[model samples]
Each structure stands twice: as structure tokens, then as C-alpha cells.
Target: MNKAQEKPIALSIRNLVKTYGKVAAIDNVSLDIASGEFLSLLGPSGSGKSTILMAIAGFVTPDSGEILLNGQKIDALSPEKRQFGVVFQGYALFPHMSVRGNIAYPLKLRGIKGAELDAQVERTIDLVHLSALADRMPRQLSGGQQQRVALARALVFDPSVVLLDEPLSALDKKLRAELQFELRSLHQRLGTTFVNVTHDQEEAMTMSDRIVILRDGAVQQIGAPDSLYNRPSTRFVADFLGRANFLEGAVSSVNGTELKIDVKGIAVRHAKGKDAAAQGEKTLLALRPERIAVVSPDQAKTSLNRIDGSVQTSAFVGSQYVYVIDTPLGTIESQMPAFEAGPLRQPGAQVAVTWSPEAGVLVKDK
Candidate 1:
């Protein structure tokens, strides 16, 4: 299986460019989606995530470049000839159709009928766990059930690839989370290549095997969720994926693997990463808010990185306490779990803020 996985690419988007009048919706985007893998195109609204997806679906014609599926050029193929299953944002089910009718729509379109259609519809309804509600109308089904119907409709045709466009965006937070897990499980069961588009970072992180982040109609970074979260390639990626503290400063000294930076009247030390500029060059430290801590004076006094700050504001979340510290390096946010050994600092109280050198990630100044 591993050898087969390395044999050939499943889908390749090479320098795909789509322009509408003066605007370039998909600006020279390229990607290689592996067989039986789940990939996500994630970005905020108007970032061209949907445009790239529509291009892949053959709905939008590109100005240049090529789209290859299984090493075959597919840019000229019509949407129907592409043979890719697509689940749109809205359920898009026919209101008059029953759950079984909706699930069997694609199979019907393929000209399958009689016992074959009945068997396929039964199998699909069972696959989506909608056997009990097969007779229910679209208006009678819940949002989650309707979503399952949509998914069943997409998978009923047996397309080798599946495209989902914010399939669970209409659901509540908890329901959406539940459906994300369900979608992952379905993908695992089917072993079909899935390319999903969404702006929800958590959804992208939890559901995708890899995520492609887009900005200004181009791909900014493509990697596993953890890799993208831990080592963001750009400031836009770091800020968009999650909350990060931007510490701007100039490099003061470089000693082997460690480098010292002068930031906001305070000297802060960090590990020298590949993206770090040369000595004396300005850089920005991208530190996760949760990585910083409010240390007591007796907790491991170190000369490397230390700052005295007052708590500008504090909030007690259910599982943790969030604090904003007003220091020389602007306002740095820190999170402390509620079950920790000691009491947390109150608002307007002086506290010692500290983070290890490894916790602070240095990148090119943005």
C-alpha cells in the first residue's frame, strides 16, 4: 500500500490562474493532492478558496496552467465528465424529494434503475445511517440528517474524489463539531480523496490530513495541521490560523545556535531558526499566547528573558484563566489552566512574565 501510495499523484493543480475582468480570483495556485488523502483549502471570505475549488470542479475556466487527475489533463473536461462528487454549502436537495429519492438522485442520473438502483439506494441509506428516515421529506429532516442526505447523495454515484464546500457551516457549534468527526470517519471508510473548503480553522485542523492556506488568490502554505500551526511560513498564516503574539525587535547578538534580540527596551533571547534574518536585522517573534506564563519571583530566575508587567485585564474561563499583561513589549496575553497549584493574578496586579527561549519563534519581520 505504501508503495502504491508513492506510485503516482492523484490530483495536480499546476499554476492554475483564473481572472475575472480586473480581478484575479485564483492567482497561480499549484498543489499535488495524494490518493485517498483529505485536503482542505482554508481562508477567510474573499480569499479565493472557493474560486480555486470551483476551478477544480470545472465550474471556472482558468486563464493558464493545467489540472491533472491521475496524470491525465482534466482542464478541458466538463463538470459532468469530471466524475467528481460535490457537496455544496447548502443541502441543495429537492424539497419534494424524499430522503431515499435525494440519495438516489445521482445514481438515477447515471441511468441506473430497477433492482440495481434499489440495491444502491438501500446501501447508501445504510451507509449514511439514514435507513429509518428514508421516507422522510427534506423539510421533515433535521439539519444534521439533511447533511447526511447530502453526503449520501454525493457518495451514491461512487466518484473516486469528493469535494465538500463548508458542508457543516449551517449547523450549531456543537453539531458542527460532531459532523466534522462524522465526515472524517466517512472518509476513512470510503478511502476516497476528499478536498474540502472552509474558513473554520478548527474544522480544517481537525478534519484534514493536510491544509492549504490561501490569501489574495494564492496559496501561502500547505502542510499538516500541526506543522502549519507550529511553524507558520508567514505572518499572515500565523495570525490567521490562530492567536499569536507579534514581538518586533532587532537582533543584537548572535552566539552559535542562540541569538539575542533587543525588543521594546528589553533584551529577549530566542533560538536561531532558518527564517531568522542576519544579525542586526529586524525580526518578529511569533509566540503563542498559551506558551507565556506568569511566573513567581522564586520560579527559576533567568537572565535570558524576563519582564515585569501589570495585568491589564483578566477573565476566568471554565477550564482556564486568560490574562493580558501590559509590558514594555506591548500587551502579551497568557493562559493558565484553572487546575494549577496556585492562585492566579488579579487585574491591575504586578506579575512577572516569562517564557523559555524555545517558546518564542523568531521569523522575518512582517
Candidate 2:
């Protein structure tokens, strides 16, 4: 088991369901968050990621089911009573409040005073690297700085859990990337249970120990970032987590731990997974673009599953070259590192794509 799984449960959501009119915003979702584990609720819009976070924070009441914190049910607790720090999408800093004042507000609300409040505020500000700008107003700080201030505010009270609702979505791409690292580092340093909600796949994969993928109003899959990305259980997950090229075929034969599939009359070999299909059963294989290697037809290895194709198009995407290869199976996307892709293949260049049997993950056709 992973370290997170070894730890005790910090929070648990059991049979959580919420609805509006006839639509269920959050279906019967159940999850257990390990102590100090950074978990992300990730999905597209209207997927109930935010609703689950809000329910945990006591802001949204569930239609049914219970929320337990450290084994104690807290379904009746108010937002403030829950004592969970929340950083909303908007920084929501008070215009009149200085950095120090904003971070101190939480303490003051709890009746903390004088030296105690000031010391806590200063320490949290320093933690977020905003000590130099303690007196600056929200308008005076850059977007990154403002985000830090908001994070400082959340950490000031030293809550057991911190909920972040797409906290870095408002920043530019570069700043967002920088903050993703910083936020992940902060979570580690603080060792606080963090439940983050976001629609950005990269952001969730970057900062989360485990990701809960939701669709519509239900949980689709929950697992470690690499596990979910590599062994996605459904078509939506395979497509959502990253760029995946799916090969549809029927299992022609099973040889020990491997299965040979027939894709458009060509035999495709795949390593058997837990849900290995029976012979003659339809199968769908999820192959990541980066797993495919483009080579000259003569250079293809017999041990690997090889498909003859011609480069339909190729685009250089900084670190890698993404190629659209037209093969008998269908159009397949391949990503190769720029340094190793050799000379770029022009349109209609005859090439063959090869990948190990293990590279093709068996996924539910759905």
C-alpha cells in the first residue's frame, strides 16, 4: 500500500447525493481521504467536483448521506464550525485589508487576540513567502502574490484540511505552472489534508496524490495520478487524462499472459490486464501517443506490434513532435521527443509505428 493509504482517514464522504430540480449535481459519491494526502476532485464542468468540495466544507448540504471527519459525523456542522480552510477560485481578498489583515481575519473570528494573532499571521505569511508584502493591499500585489496571500490566509488558522477550488485558474499559463509547483511544495511542508477541485488535467495530475475523476454527477475512477493515466478503466478517462489513440478490435487469441487482437485485419498484440477479454470478445486498447515509435518499415521489430502507416501531418510541439499517422487501423497520433525523432517526417512520408504489447492498455469499450 502507498503511504497515503497507510495513514488514517482524515475525511469520509458516504453516499453523498445532491440535486437541483430534476438534475443530480452530486450523485451517490463515497470517498475516503487519507490524512495529509493531497487529493483532487477532477472533471469537466457540471461534473460535481465543486459540489463535493462544497459539501465537505459545509457550504452545500447533501440530499442524502453523511460526511465524517476523523470518524466523527459532521453533517450538521456549519461552514465556520467545520474549521476547514477554503481558498475559492477568486482570491476574494478584502480591498481595504492589507496582507497581514487578510491573513489575520480567520484568527480574529475565533477570538484570538494581540500577540497570538499577530505571531500566527506573521508566521503564515512567511510560510507563503509574502512577509515582505505584509502591508501591501490586494491591488498592490501581483496575481501570484495575491494568490500567495490567499493561501497564507487559509494556512494561518492551521486547519486540519484545506479545500482549494481551482485556486490557480485565474493566473496566466506560466504563472499557473510556477504556482502548481509552489502549491504542491506547500502541501508537503504543511502536511495538511488538502482536497482540491479542478478541471485542468495537468494541474490535478501535478499536485494530487490521488485524483477522483467524475463525470456528470458520479465518480468514474479514483487512483494515483500515474495509475489512472496508465490504466484508465473507461473511454472517458482514457481520453480525458491525456491524448490517447484507441484501437478497436476483437480478441483473436490469448497466449498465456498476452492477447492477440485483430484490428482492421491486422493482428495487434497486447499484454493481458486484470479484465482480460475472452476469445472473440470485442476489445478496445488505449495507447498513449508517446508510447508509439515511428520507424522505417524495414526497421520494424518483429517482437513489437507494428503497423505500416504514412505520416499525414507532423507538428513540432517544443519538447516533442506530434505526428498524425494514417494506417489501416485508423488515424493514430504519435508523440516522439524532438531530440530522438531524428529528422521530422513530412506529409505522406511512409513510416511504420511500433509499440510493445504492454503499451496497449486494455480498457472497457465504454
Candidate 3:
């Protein structure tokens, strides 16, 4: 885990809103980004993720609320005056300029003299591991290399913060994965606060120290990757972060941190322990598919939760087997590791699906 510093806050947004006539593009939103941290704003298209990044970069002025950097208001400041480096979705490299010239442009614009400009460009090239391709033009380099060149150009000036708007979206999967590792390593080496926006969940999880999930122009949740994955707050978040089986039920009892939910005709006991549901309230339980286990019918092992169902279908997916079972409540999905030693269950086979109480997390019915 990365330890957050106790320095002054890097960026703070309070009650931010952007309305375009009849449509409220961005609703009231508040966020705090710690200094020297890597944070990712992750959401689908039109979810206001990019809008928040633009607001932070001073590209789009918010209709209301203040944009603060180190606790000083900068809402009225121009984009150049804000002094934040930006790398947009496409690698917006000038086709006419070589990689060295691209990196030197920022320093040149700042009126850095001959020797300083050369040194800064060389240093930036080394920082992005592009020393060998300094003389290569944008059109001559691969997509991954071009993206790195753009990144080098952005960081050459050593700005206080960097805003990355899906920098690796153009690369192939393998290249994207490679760049993801490089970006994380670079963030650690530079210790610069990075605010990035991406719609890819894997990218968000792989690179960010904290993730801000947005939806419908509002923040849905914000937490570390593991925290968000293990304990999602809303139905949308659970579904978006990963695959989840929704169990609709009404809470029958709440004792301390425990909950008893009635699903269909069965009263299922859940040990959400610290995440208890309100008594006599309707709730949706998020059951991760991987947490379920398929058991033999005769194995009468007493467990926290158990359902008898017929295997509706099963598919082997190399490393794991996905099974769909029709239980009394509803169709439940479970995944089991593919084993070479045994023959798995076929369609219409009767089986028992069992999970621990804590596997089912009580969430909003939204």
C-alpha cells in the first residue's frame, strides 16, 4: 500500500456543477486529491469523468463551485496559468517535429536558453525510456512509443500536477498493459500528483492508488481498489467493478452487524458483520460469482447459506468453469477452477450451491 503524505492538499473540488442549458452535464460533486498521489476518475462515456478532469485542468470552467490547488482558489485562472501538464486521449504529437523537438517545445516556450533546453529535452527522453528514439518523428514511432513521447513532452516542464485523459486508450491490449506498468513506475519515480481519467476498469485498477467511480454525472464511490472491489456501496458499482449476482430480499432481522434476509421462500442468514442491513427493509445482496461453490447433494455440511438447484448450463473457460444454476430464488452463477482430474457436472445435474455468510454483501436495491 502507498502511504499518503501529510502535506497540504493538492486539489479539492467542492459542489462542482456544469449545466448546459436544459441539461446538467455535471451535478453537485466534491472530491479531494492528495498530493503526490495517483488518482483515477473511472466511469462510462457521458458519466462526467472527463468533465471533472477538464475542470481540474482549467479547460472547462465550472458553472458553480471552486477549484482549489493547495487550498488556493484557481477557478478563474487560465489553463496556461494553472501550470498543470495535460495529455489528452489521442497522442496529440506534432507530426512535423521529432521526439527531441517535441519534448523541447515546452522548455522553449518558457524561454529556456540553449544549454538548458538541450539538457531538459535529454532528461525527459531518458525519463520516458525514449533516449534511442529522440530523433524519430511521431509518424515513424509505434502507437505505444508515440504515447510515451507525448507523456515525456508533458512532464518535461516538471509541472505540479499531470492530467492524463486516457493516454493508453489507443494502444493494443498487450501494449496497454505494458504502458500501465510503466506509468505506475513513473508515478513512483517522479512523485508527482497524477489525475487520470479512463473508462477501462482494468486500467483504473492497475494504475491508481485511489479510484473515483462516477455515473450519471455524480460520484458513485471513492476508495482504494481492493476496498471498492470487496465492498461496493451501490448496485451500479458492484456491477461495474466486476460481475455480481444480485439476490433480492427483504431484511428480516438486524443484530449488531449481522443480517437475516428473506429471499423467495427461504430465510438466508448473512454475516455482513460490519455491513449490516436495516431491519424490515428491502435490500439487494451482491454475491460475487467466484465466492460460490458447487457441492454434492449428499454432502449435508451445515453452512451459513445453501441453495439446492439444477445446473442449467456450464461452460469451461480454460482456467475456470462457469455454471448457471436454477435455484428456488433465481438463477445463480458460480465459478469453479477447472481441474484435469475430474469430470465436471453437465446440464440438468442437481447440485448444492453454498457460500459463507460474508460472501453476500448487502447493498442498495438501486
Candidate 4:
């Protein structure tokens, strides 16, 4: 959560490549996961996120490259020797094993017994706050509780790193959200290195200190949640991480960090980063719906990024109104907070979608 750069490198992957015959599962990946940091590998199915995690856990052998722990290569090590705690989606708790038996399984495998094993099991159950359900079987526990048991089982042996493969994906939405909060709190409390793989964007963003976006077996962008969300490097990332309104335009002018681009004959200002170049290349800009405001046509003021559009459709989604507006450029989605006093921005209504220059981010089309 803090300056992870100064911390020791817990895991490092250099030029990692793996292929299943003709298909490439992981392609030329390099990453450094800092000690005591929570990093999420987020992507759709078959994006190589799982393959990378498997390689780190020594479950899958990569076709090339190296995996280092504390700067020591461990590619030839087996899964058991890696000592990484892994929690799968199924919770994988033995049906016959009680909560206590499940959490004590790993320790028992190592020949620990008697008072020491009992104390370790008890301590881990308390860590996950599963004391009340320690005697319950997997069939009797709720999905969340079963997940907690799986976590306790994973942490009982105190591995150097923990790998979670969508552990909360089996639970209900409410339960999932609750466990997400719990996971975040637990990570902070334990300060253990966690590598999570999930297809859910909000889940990754909610619990991860940093997120690595993978696309078709390669890394697209890696950064903090806010950086990846607000300043996505590519079009796929912007579209995947969140809802985005992409506007393609030709570069009109560049003034240091200020950029002016022409989009469908409508000029929009863009705020550029330090590496922004004036290569006269056409660029795409991503605008988040939440950053856009719906203004009544009569009260709309001329701004740097104000467009008159008709609301094609609008849905009242609890706290906000999500509208699909059609303009000359294309279909744009805008989200506005629900107000108690005003009329809703309904369908076929004329409105102005206004946003600041800072709201538009330049992203790579590829």
C-alpha cells in the first residue's frame, strides 16, 4: 500500500513464456511482485493470468524464462516445495473434514501433532473469525464461511505467499462484497504477499494494492487501481477495466501537456502525460461515464467538452441514472446521480453531456 518499490522483491518473473502446443498460454511476461503487497492479475478467460499464477505456484511448467523468489530461481521446484498457499474457487474443503480438521490438514502432513497442532489450528480459525463454526462440516457451512475455512487452511502453515484463484466467485453478491472487505482488512493486518487472479474488475480493484491487466497471454498495463482505471494505456484496458466512451480523433495541436484533437469535426481538449508526443498521429480518448454530467438543453453552457445529444435510453440504477445518448460522433453512455427534487433524464430527452479536459484520457487503440 505504501512504497513497495523500496521493499524486497518477493517474486520475479523474467521473459516468462508458455505454450500449449499451438496456443500460447503465457507470452513473454516480466513482472516483479513486491514483498507484503497485494497484486491482482485481472483479465477475461484464457488471458494467461491463471497460467502465470500456476507457473509461480509450480503447478505448470513454463516453456521458457525464469521465476525467482528472493532473487533465487525456483523454476525446477515442485508445487509442494514452493510452499505457496493456494485457495481455489471450489473452496476445496474435504467434505468429510470438519473445519478444525481442514485447517489442521497441512500441519498434520508436516508431522506436527498434539498441543502444537491444536494451538496452530485454533489460532488460524480465530484469524479468519471462524471460531463459532470450527466444529461445522463443509456441507453445513455457508459459502462465505466455507471460504473463510479455506483461507484459514491456506494460512495455517504460514506460507511466504498466498495465491487465490477467484476464491469469492462462488458466493452471492452480498457475500462476495463482505468477503472482499474482509480480504482487504486481512491483507493489511497480515502484511503477507497475495497474488490474486480474477475476471471481476471491481473485485480486483477493491482488494488489490496494484493490478496487472492481461490481454491474450500478455500484460497490457500494470499500475495502482486508480492509475489503471483513470489512465488506461490501451483501448482494450479502458473498455475492460470499466465502462468507457472512446472517441477517436486526429491530433490537431500539442502544447506541452495540453492537447487539442478533432473528433468527427468536434474538437475536444485532452490532458496529456509527460511522455505525450506530437507525432501528428490519430489517437483515441477514453471518457468515463461518471465524469460526464447531464445538463438540460436550456441551461447547458458552452464548455470545452459539451455535446448536445438525445438520450436514447435511460435506466434508474438505484443511486444513479445511466443513459445511452446518441450524438454525431457515436453512441455515448453517461451516468448522473439521482436527485430527489428533479425529473429523471428520460428517453428522447435533449441534454448536454459536459466534462472537463482532464476527464478525457489518451489511450492506445491497439
> Considering every candidate listed, which one attains the maximal TM-score?
2
Residues 105-172, model 4: lDDT tens digits: 99998899999999999999999999999998999998999999999999999888999989999999
TM-scores for the candidates: 0.94, 0.98, 0.93, 0.96
Quantify all predictions' global Cα lDDT against the true fold. 0.87, 0.93, 0.88, 0.90
Q: Write model 2 residue lDDT over 227-337, tens digit each, in one string.
A: 999989988999999989998999999988899999889988888856578999998899999999988998895647998989999999999999999998889999999
lDDT of 1 at 266: 81
Count of backbone collisions within predicted model 4: 0
Candidate 1 yields a Cα-based lDDT of 0.87
Ranking of all predicted structures according to TM-score, beginning with the best and ending with the worst: 2, 4, 1, 3
Clash count in backbone of candidate 1: 0
Which residue ranges in model 1 land beyond 4 Å of their true spot? 1-7, 273-276, 298-300
Model 3 TM-score?
0.93
What's model 4's TM-score? Answer: 0.96
lDDT score at residue 127, model 1, on the 0-100 scale: 91
Query: Model 2 TM-score?
Result: 0.98
Steric overlap count per candidate: 0, 0, 0, 0
Error of 3 at 242 (Å): 1.1
Return the lDDT, model 2, position 332. Answer: 94
* TM-score winner between candidates 3 and 4: 4
Kindly give the stretch of ten consecutive residues in candidate 3 with the minimal lDDT sum: 1-10
